[model samples]
Target: MRDVQWIYSHEVVARPQSQQPTARIPAPTSAMQTCGPLLFAACRRRGRPSPADAVCRCLVIHLSARHDGTARRGGSVAATTKPSRLAASPTLPRVPIPTRTRSRMHLHQLKPGEAASLPRHLLEAHVVALVRRCCPGLLALRAAHARLIRLRLPRLTAAFALSKLLASSSSCGAAPSYARNLFDQIPEPTAFCYNSLIRALSSAAGAAPAADTVLVYRRMLRAGSPLPNTFTLAFALKACSIVPALGEGRQLHSQAFRRGLEPSPYVQTGLLNLYAKCEEVALARTVFDGMVGDKNYAAWSAMIGGYSRVGMVNEALGLFREMQAADVNPDEVTMVSVISACAKAGALDLGRWVHAFIDRKGITVDLELSTALIDMYAKCGLIERAKGVFDAMAERDTKAWSAMIVGLAIHGLVEDALKLFSRMLELKVRPNNVTFIGVLSACAHSGLVNEGRRYWSTMQELGIKPSMENYGCMVDLFCRSSLLDEAYSFVTGMAIPPNSVIWRTLLVASKNSNRFDIVQSASKKLLELEPCNPENYVLLSNLYASNSQWDRVSYMRKKMKENNVNVVAGCSSIEINGYLHKFVVSDDSHPEIKEIRLLLREIADRVVRAGHKPWTAAVLHDVGEEEKEVALCEHSERHGSWLPALTGNATTMSTVGVYSTARQIFR
Candidate 1:
């Protein structure tokens, strides 16, 4: 309002030395003239104006000065060599000159709670709007939160801000406890607040058990107000799916149905997934059918996934086909289940078809789906294709690497498997128990005794305890290498009790080596653990006969008959064009038995010509030497190998006829 001297002026005006020659500045601009002293006086009187009002005033002043070509460089005002009209006018009040400190004071120094004259409702509205904009960043949010607490913001406004913080933290992968702490500080959280916390906890994998979601939901229910909505049941059902809590999930379903919320798409999908994950496929199907043609992609996917998880491979494939026929598009989740079903069935053609479909449809090969593809290719005996997919992955997670390593391990590619494991470590990807299992199995299968010991030590160093499967692999490693004493010692010294699988591995190894010293203990332990497994009795019988203990063998046989335990005969299978042909020892059920027998005679003649005599020691029957040799030639496994050769061309003979036998040494 008064003539204020320009701070960046290069010239001084003429004045008396004693008076300091008060510098004459130009009148205030028209825009400032219109506002006059009212805005600044109000702000000065009120301590601080609203941030928005302050910002608006700054923009107006800057734009007005710029339009008049009076803006100067370095944010300084341009000085004019003219007398100020305001200085001569005695009818006006003087306005304070705007400075950096005053501008900042108006913007940031305002205490929100100090605005007492403003209605409480309007203050809370401003805080809510501020929180909505700040929700995307934690730092901005915390700063906002601090300002609110410092100003003692209304409880409702603070609660909403805390709720947003919890939701944002959940999405950003912050610890759920951080949100829990914030939630606890609220005096009384609304249903929205409770739902925010529940949803956050529901999605936090590996942080807490799914049961935590159930507990939070119970707390909400008991709060007696701000009751749950459809979103609440949806998240609760998902948590139940994670825990596979069929009982809790069913209760939620009943509650939702009673409340007329079951028709909600989100709630229905969650319930369907819950029952499916709980392996109640029938219930899941009921949920699906009740929709009466309202099934979405997720509903179909959940049904297919349920069947696949329960090992109903055929049903899964059938449903997948039905899903396609119904014109319902499949997402990555659905294809993952379809690929997994193909893996279980060893349907290589079908797996390839799915892979081609993915490429054709431009579906994203995300980590989970890529892992499933690797597993499918590997299990279908296409390790090369599995490796191709593994190599093509742009980002490999633990699951992808583990699946590839396990695939190689099962295919006897021990070197490749271990190399991949080493590479995974070098890449700083922490190998979990599943990864260790694959590496240990590779070592076991490849007879790498030193490597097995090294890995076992490394596993311990990595703070991974040897699971039952790991222990079994170690036992198998020693057994395969004919170190029976070490194998037995390893089993007995296990930190955890040896499982039936470990005992079976040791028993079979002992029988093969004729190490009867270890047999008695291993057999007793095996029988104790698996009393009804007829294979165990058969193994004991065979072991006794191997040692020429005919009387004991007969006693074992009589006991088996008394127990009505029929042995599971060893069988070998060959896959030809997706059809599997299985053969049991002494089986004559095949229509091509005549040709198979003739091929067997030819193979026996050829083997005799090659100077390889039949080994009859494996014959468990108490018979003469000639009878044993004849039985050996008539073994179904021997016929199984020869049938494919006689039935197919030379190429098929080289590939298809070489079926792996399913015979165990103990049997």
Candidate 2:
């Protein structure tokens, strides 16, 4: 696919006017657009790069069929181009800026706080310095820098004079006004000059700088300047990616194709990356298919990852396997995408296959892959297996330990998780913000109040700052233990603002304790934080029903309908001997419905005999609690579990439930 996109390049870029003798440009005008911006402007000037000793403007960018004239019509030139360290384009000319000095009267004429304004002389240097940080693709700057360039530069003085009026201090970053003034003097800028400006504008952070990159693209187009090279397009694409300007991206890509740039690996990669981010993986694949060769790894990875993220795991795996067959060895990024695909497919057997492959191929298992595997095993109901992998790791980062701890906590092994956390401390593996979340979760899952307090105080003792999630977890732990006022005081005295998740956790804990006022408060806050979340409304209605307020419950239900909130469907999933079966409440969609019903009936009788009562509040949400117990006994996982028990050697086997939480086990 990559090979197909290459354009015939027999000395493609034309030499600048100041160089190769046969040059007749017919002056700059709209007619220049016929030839495209990169070439036309790139063709215009043939001179030494600015600061002749340094290669300031030797760059060539390609856009493919993705980024449009956001540099022109749409107002952006940013693409999130996957940066690669490669030599700069040889044919491109270097920037050769002239010296200039700012007059004292110009300094007097300058507006207050206008120092950062750019000067033409320093424009090439200042922009190079600034953009190299945000986007490092511009290799020309590797040799030159701002402070190294002339400090009393003429362009700097000119920009300084212009900044006295046209610009403000904040507009120029650390660039001086003289550099800003240089921009006006060089009315007929070489592509190097334009590249510098594009680099600076394209790199401006956030939406504001994003908008500026587009304006610059447009200005170049209006000037009948040649389109930017693939490198320039890549930078602009980064901005478009940030703001998600698809139309602008598409236009730039088309312009790139027109400029005969479809073959460049950089352009194709950026196109695929941008398209994937927009949830356009199909389009990204189309771009990937046109890549020239192994040069398009970024493009392939982007498309594969986009598919994997959206749950098209089979397709992602297929592409990766195909890449392998083609001998395109997977890099760390490629492995990350494939590992994610394995997780999404719930393919634990396949995960083992990958692990074996990594071992046989001598591929180092990175922290990311290890973490994904931990999550995969946990989700697959293989907690022991997950632990084995976690313990055997050569080295572990905070996230790796956090993933293992969280996996254990979620699987009803809180003590084991905490024990591993203790090991982490003994090994001097410092915990980050995420470590607290895992620890707090362990406490919540195990109903360990005293242990939670001790660990929490120790957290402060260790100088760890508790984030909002930590606070929520602690509140839920306390509330679940029926420590109502303690939970209340903890939440009210939170150091950070609580979000809806925190409120919802508090509300659920309050519900278990029958704390009506706290429930009301938490629900109110949840509503404010998540106004569109219907669960809060439904839960509040359910809470009123719990207290026997049928009228209030009915009113809440009416409001639900008025606001278009629907009850979330209940779902249960069970993993049995490597196969997962899902059961939705009241759903009879499985193949062996008759057998499932029989197993569920038998489980209900046994659960009741074992003292599992019908749910109370739900029974009167209009039935008797007795009838509700019948309903509880038939809960989805219990039903799903029965099918597994029926298939296994029932009397000899203990049902091991793979749950997202310990409460699920109790349920």
The candidate that wins on lDDT is 1
Tens-digit per-residue lDDT, 263-326, candidate 2:
7787788788878777787788888887886644666678778887786666787787887787
Whose TM-score is greatest here? 1
| lDDT (Cα, tens digit) per residue for candidate 1, span 409-436 | 9888999999999999999998888898
TM-score of each: 0.69, 0.60
RMSD of 2: 17.3
Clash number for candidate 2: 79
Error of 1 at 441 (Å): 2.4
